[model samples]
Target: MTAARTEQAPGTRAPDAPENDVVLRLEDLVVEFPAGGGQTVHAVSGISLEVRRGETLGLVGESGCGKSTTGRAIMQLPRPTGGAVVFEGRDITKLSAAELRETRPKLQMIFQDPISSLNPRRRIPDIVGDPLVVWGRRDERAKVVPEVLTAVGLDPEQVADRRPHQFSGGQCQRVSIARALVLEPEVLICDEPVSALDVSVQAQILNLLEDMKARYGLTLVFIAHDLGVVRNISDRVAVMYLGKICELGETEELFDDPVHPYTRLLVSSIPSMETVTGADIEKADRGRGEMPSPVNPPSGCRFRTRCPLATERCAAEVPEMREVRPGRFAACHYPMLEPVGAGAAVEGA
Candidate 1:
């Protein structure tokens, strides 16, 4: 995170954000799929966010919270069911197939399963350079491929001729990064890029991403369930619940003083330095009900069933995101951090 970071409250300009600097924006994005028997899986619902140039925006949430779906929606992978995906001042969702293909080079994604993302039969150079060939830069593939491969710390001489299975998980991820960078993209959506690796390897991949971001002058949308990992890498963090954003703020601020009930639970559940034994999953599970299925998410506030602060109003009306403090926003009728004139009604108060 940058020392001079600006807080990013939705619908308001940060002091540091100049007009035309936002690299990507999602407006009222929605994604849904039929679950058979007249049911619908609400993967993402009415979520809006933006990523500024050269900034890393972290999307944090537990499994099935739609963070990964949000990232894929940004790529227009399935063409979002509603709303727009604005990239570089254009709504990519409206682009024709040819236009979208042309725009893809500027927006790339790194999937969670690195080894599976690569082809088991293809050599490294062919895999990394395939984008060039597909995008009509086949002539430059020979020169550009090795440069990015070397940039990602893989020796072309050694790994370029080998297949993905030969490399360890971390090395395979490096290859994935190299492939994403081959197009010199401005935005990289990393969906849990380190979740499958060893703890030590996770650090290496995170550092590698930081290096790659700086080297390419890239903006990143980093999606992961690990709060600790997001804290270490993201400039700003958006905490998601069910299918919507519950809180958004600068990294340290959100972690140090979480305002949303869900955010508080997530931050507290992270293993502290004193608790090397790791988070007490059983204990944490006992404190909250099972996350509702997206096919039938709770009305009004999806987290009300588990929130200690939930009220009748929380169940009756949806909470719109509002500024809880300077540059921090939370979508809760009864936020953990109450306003100055409001009563303090949080748990353990």
Candidate 2:
């Protein structure tokens, strides 16, 4: 959304991207699970995308929609069964132990749970400094830990000696971030970074990430299920359903004019702003039904089972990604983006 120039739908170049800024590119990425019955769950179906240097790309979808799996595949934390994860022009899917170790300094992950991600046995300083130590910066870690701690809104002097249980959830997440960032990674894959925190704490952490992005020139792969949060942070957003990308565009464009039926439903599903909102616990689950199981997702367009606009064709054929306009992509046999000045609905959407 950073004033990026438009090419065909799903533009190849970014708006306001610096000459040397583009960082991570995920091309034809597929993540699958092999089961005993010769049944494979294609968790992430051949999705291609690019994350520019200093840009935040959001991957939003339902819980079982492979958002987290995509992040895991990028980090190769859980071995990816197929597809390529390219970082700075290198395909990491084929790297060996030593090669992965060399690459680790530039790629890092901030996990979803703050409390669980940190080890209860480790003190704050040791936890934050672990990345530095692993990267052979032990001597310099002394100077770096305090700086990193302070950067993440933590007090180095008072909390340095405490274990994970000593601090609150928000503080633990900050510690986790400090740990991931201490080594100065170029690309950080945040797997639902704010999903586990209290809303206030979530805001604090989000602000920290924004600041860190500016200071460190970080390329962020932010994964989450919330639309408002994605709108606030991402330059580009890709909406997924049942393991495949349903829509992709700059944040403002996608939200302002969603081109896919599934996307419109997602936008419509955002908690209506003026209503006496449901209790915080139930708000996110209010309008949506249980997400369909991925093990045997609906055929053709996996979302057809839940799609209000689904037709016979939707259940029988996989729609191709079509360029609906300047810099937007939608996978739909009947791309239902509301035409400019026309009815506020796209075909079958």
Q: After superposition, which runs of candidate 2 have C-alpha atoms over 4 Å from their true positions? A: 1-20, 36-38, 274-289, 339-349
Candidates' RMSD to native = 5.4, 5.5
Tell me the tens digit of each residue's lDDT in model 1 across 1-349.
Answer: 1222233435433446775788887778899999989999999999878788999999999899999999999998788999778787778888899999889999999999999999999999999999988878899988999899989999999985799999999999999999999999999999999999999999999999999989999999999999899999999999999999999888988887677778867876788885312222222334575788999999899898887666788799988877777778788886766422243344334
Candidate 2 lands at a TM-score of 0.88
RMSD of 2: 5.5
Clashes found in each candidate (C-alpha, N, C closer than 3 A): 0, 5
- The 10-residue segment of model 2 with minimum total lDDT is 276-285
For all candidates in order, the CA lDDT equals 0.84, 0.79
Model 2 lDDT per residue over 61-135, tens place: 888899999999988877677666777767787789889879978999999998999989989999899877776
